[model samples]
Target: MKKMVYASLLFIFFSTLFSLADTTVLKPSKEEEIRDTIVVHGMVLHGRVTGIGPQRLSFKLRYSDGTNRIAYKDIDSIYTKYNYRISFKRMDIEGRIVGIEENKQYLKILEGNHERTVKIADIDNFIMAVSEDDSFENVVRNKFPYTKGSIHAGLEVENGINRKNTADVRLNLKRKVAEHETRFFLNYNFETTQTADEPKVQNKDELIAAATYKNYFENEQFFFASLAAEYDRPRQIQQRWLPSVGYGYKFTFDKAFWLEPAVGLAYATTQYTDIQYQDDQFTAAALRLSGEYLMDDVIYINTLIIDGNIMYYPSLTAAEEDWIMRSNLGFSIPLFDFLSVKFIIDYTNDSNPDPEVGNNKTTSSLLFGFDF
Candidate 1:
């Protein structure tokens, strides 16, 4: 009888222990309980917030195929279950975004049951959430601010009555942090031709470099300044400088494309490499009219991308017939996650050109490159 009683007691104790263990195992951790959610145009998106900008929000969709980058005014609301480190002009806060007041231009954050309101204009930066296992070293190494750039190169060789070799390299770098955006561009091309009657001769050597900066403001209006320099040996242009400043507005048409039209005053000066072309050198005030366009997933095909820009400088101080126009267009198709094949066409026209070289120049290239 004593053995039977002891056995019953032991079984009850083990059972109780097992039940507690099972209960503990079924409980979820805080990370598993929290999820990031965004509501835009009545559509609820369950995803991780990749970035927050003054005018836009970048989201990594949980159930979608592509990233969602929408203007702040378009997003109805956002909620972050985990704490995100948000920076302002003079202070920083660690909290979750509970609400977004688009009309009032403010954000409601929850910190330890206390709600605080912060103006959108006061925000300087927004970083993604940090994980429990994330150390300071790892965060710095993994989440450091970086620029996006691409390098494209192409070569063409032909053999016939005249052997011709042509090569070109182009580089583009872009960085957008908060309200400031910057871009840098470089392109170089070389060509050589050899005839059976003569030795090989270099016919083309061209280099172009340009840098632009923009300070964004409300309602897609911004202030922009740019400077560009060019050298074309084939055209007898030793150097050319273009500096412009202007006010511009961006028009976003849905999520597929945008167009920006800008008008401003500019100054252009040219130096000729040939002594006989000295008369062509001139510095003059000009009216700068430029337009830029970008389209992604063209026609919803999801693989084609098109981007281009056109700049027309009509000389104000120089003769009426001495205007210049430059236009570029590019088409790209992604071959991999980071690699793409691009075809580009560049055209330049100078109303006044060296008598030896023509007034129009056109170049096209097919290049392969990867973006980082």
Candidate 2:
């Protein structure tokens, strides 16, 4: 029995020793070989400096190479001991397969040192590039264009005996092309008002009609325009026919503020009853100057307008002159990607006031429109 026990002990010692040796020699299987090669591209990886000074830097990069295994390595390079942000763009970083052991593969980087092993299939490519020039180019391509049209109907109430409240309808169609530098517009408006307050007044309700066509061209430096118009209206004690032509120029500063000055000429004819009281046609001319302030994104405020007009009638052997001033405060709000709402309040003053006619008029309006 003692001999049997001694033999058993000897066998156990040898077995233990052999097992230890086998553990030291153990390695990954062949199935892990494919996982050793990984391709990386377009990635911005961050790292910290482990060692500093004139020698070489030991950087440990904690990054994933398109694999399940996280990689950590110390790269040896001549760099300062400071934190650095590095970005890779449109380039591939490849690691060659070295070995596979215990169902795991080892990888070695070809270019950068202190590299560690990563699984082969986990590398990523295609990173974002950074540059001011690229950003400016994007702005040019993504610029917002300004173009719109709208139709509005409202009720206009006036204080007069012959006129009751009437429906005022206006249609405006406009299009902007050439990067907000050129625009074409067509507008028509109709309203009904009371005839003059006199014993001889014939029509109780008078129709006021007007139409306008205009084109505007602009650039970074200046704006130019051409305008034409026709009007049939009876104001105060006289009925008038007017047709006009105009041109204007705009000046800009700081890209946010602008001033425009315009001049126009109109031919006028005055009449009373069925008989033409004033057959003479007179030329009318006016100068207008206005200023505007632009807010960020889609809002703006503007104030400043001045106008002067002179009218002459040859048949009536009479001449009339008028000067008008007006200002507007407004804002543009964006409602959607392509729609907006504009609100404005207008105030006006006339040099000649017919007591029967108001010398100053204030009006407020809201416009719903679209941008193309």
C-alpha lDDT of all candidate models, in order: 0.75, 0.39
Instruction: Give the Cα error of residue 196 in candidate 1, in Å.
Output: 2.8
Residue-by-residue lDDT tens digits, candidate 2, 1-372: 999999999999999999988986675454322121222232433432221111111233434222121222222112222212121222243222223332332223333444444342222111111221146533332232122334444455566665545443334344333223333333233444554664433222333333434344444333333333322233332454555556666666643466766666655544433242333345555454556664432223221112222222122223334433435565555444334566656564542234444555665666566533
Model 1, range 42-90, lDDT digits (tens) per residue?
9998867766645557677765656655667777888987677776644
Please give the TM-score that candidate 1 achieves against the real structure.
0.64
Q: Which stretches of candidate 2 lie over 4 Å from their true place?
A: 1-148, 152-172, 175-247, 270-280, 290-292, 297-329, 347-355, 358-360, 367-372
Model 1: weakest 10-residue lDDT segment is 286-295
The per-prediction CA RMSD against the true structure, in angstroms, equals 6.8, 21.6
Provide TM-scores for the models. 0.64, 0.37
| Stretches > 4 Å off in candidate 1 | 1-146, 157-162, 279-301
Q: Considering only N, C-alpha and C atoms within 3 Å, which residue pairs clash in candidate 1?
A: none
Candidate 2, RMSD to the unseen true structure: 21.6
